[model samples]
Target: MEQESASGLSGRAGNAEPVAQTPTPDGAQIHEDYLARARRGSIWQMLAIALSLAIAAFSIYVLGRAVSAVSLSALRQAIAATSAEQIASAALLTVWSFLALTGYDGLALRQLNARVRYKTTALASFTSYAISFTLGFPLITAGTVRYWIYSQAGLTASKVASLTVIAGVTFWFGMAFVLGAGLAFHASAISAINHFYPLINALIGVSVLGAILAYLVWVTIRHRHISIKGFQLELPGLGLSLGQIALGVIDQCAAAGVLYVLLPSHAELDFFTFAATYVFACILGVLSNAPGGIGVFEAAMLKAVPVASEEALLASLVLFRVIYYLVPFLFALAFLGAHEGFHRWTSLREAMRGSEEEKVLEDEINPLRRWYRDNWRLRR
Candidate 1:
């Protein structure tokens, strides 16, 4: 038995090859690095959120001091005092603002060399912004909506992402351009914010404009795509960037005009001054990320428009949300519902047509079967 076993082992050793094991250790090391980086990113996000919350809290406290306590009746009186023309003008501006929003996607598509119909782009832009402005998060709301809409229009995921980034940058560029113009022109506009000297606002505005200018210069000179991490960024041409700036200006102006119209003319608030304050307040609200920037936005708006009484301003703010944010959100929901209903109706009609065709084909090929079905099934 021992001799037989020895012979078998010797044959096996001579003929057998070394078995190769999968290199799991190297893969494990790579996975560990990915996890580490993800954790670090999460930590940074948490820190940023915390910071935003702190700022929001401080702003809320300051705003509390600026206004006397208001009651429901007082708010109603303020609303009652607002004129019909003011309401209509504000609504009209809100409509124009949303229309300008569609241009963000339009201009972005041009930059990306992506061909999509203006109608599709308008739907995507309108619905996405309508949802995101209220939901208070772009990634979850607008980004997902864009992905869904753009994908059906033949845009790949990366293209959609690029489109989103470009469109977002366009809004900021416009905001910066307008804000810079507003502050540079009117230094004392929103001094209540940060208690800073008027010169600081002007300087900040210049810095924002300078940053946008620098971006344009870089795009003009390099004329090359930038790669960061694994994503490729194709910057728009100088002329296109200028167009983006124009879109932003129009959107911001319409948005600010929404409130400007709502305010009492006696408030003595001019467009440029209100635009500066509105832009500043908007930035604060965006940074806070509280849903609709609820308290933070109102506070900033109230603080910036010191001429308007707290109760009257509160009424305007309420109307602004209803017209600008809430009305559009409802309309978006209605549009989505109608779209889904239409698709469902189409599917059902197609299914019925398909069944009729199959039935006719079956009857044509098998008269005996059809007769049996007609007699037996009908009798049963």
Candidate 2:
């Protein structure tokens, strides 16, 4: 009876399956299901991308038609009437204004203690701006490009992303300064204009204020031991934050001046009014996301500056694009193309050298193999 009991226990123990072990067939089926879901997700993403591209193309076509309908004769006359000196000044200012944009990146880098060469910073900055100009989505391509370039300098992806975010904050801070100053100094001028959407102005004010408050809260939370990955920026004290705001105001003032210089000399608009109108127009253009805000920007300017004729507005907008968007865009393209060309050439040269080395090794190996075979036959 005891032997029988022991034998029964042993048999049961031997037949028992391990608790933690999963069956291979079941695991494989689960994996196959996951793969199917992933494929479906990939298809959805592709469809979304296709849809977005189609919409963007359609918007561009519609905008192009609006531009083409503007009187060419008036455009030419406005172009001719623009003083050579004013145009030259505007061009110079546009270049300098963009150069100043690099300062925002530099400041952020300094804050993050990520030391990089000036040339690298400039290239990253310019390439980012250029991509933003052409692609209409600044953050996507610009961030990717920055990661590619800055990663080589020992900066992690998170740190680069942090710097980019900080740079954007500073830019908006500057914009607020321009808007606030324009509002304060030209109260009468702003009140005189009829805006299609008064709510937009209110919204702009609220957004800026909300942003500042949010930044403050973020700083407080971070100070209490919450850490943000890749960005080691401390909440700059109130004074420092104010100083950044001041810098922003200066930047936008310079930007607005570039457009102001291109406007007709006879247009009875004060600096403050021009600044206010320009700010509104810029906001509209940015929201439209037209490539470099091309058609959208012109349309916004026309709407904002109601005193100016459509022809005059169109002419000024075109000239502004020429100075600010088109020229810088072309230069940035050339710079990127040259950089890429050099990298490609170097890669090709290395590939050729690798092929030559492989051929030499093959040549030596073939002779050795033949010699070994002949010796083996003799020995046999």
**TM-score of each candidate structure, all chains considered together:** 0.83, 0.66
Candidate 2 structure quality by residue, lDDT tens digits, 1-380: 89999999999999999789665678889999999999999999888677655545654665566567777887799788888988998988777777777777787787678799988898888778767766677778778878877886689988898778877777778776566555555655565574424455545556666676676666645452224554355645454466567666666777888888877753578876777677766665566555666666665566456544566666777788777777878888788788778778989999999999997787687988767777999999
| Model 1: how far residue 252 lies from native, Å | 0.6
**Residue 57's C-alpha lDDT in candidate 1?**
94
Candidate 2 achieves a global lDDT of: 0.72
TM-score, cand. 1 vs. native: 0.83
lDDT of 1 by residue, 187-305 (tens): 67555444778899778878877888888898889676878577989888899988999999999999999988888664566688788778878888888888777788888877667
User: What is the Cα-based TM-score of model 2?
Assistant: 0.66
Q: Which model scores highest in TM-score?
A: 1
Model 1 lDDT at residue 244: 93
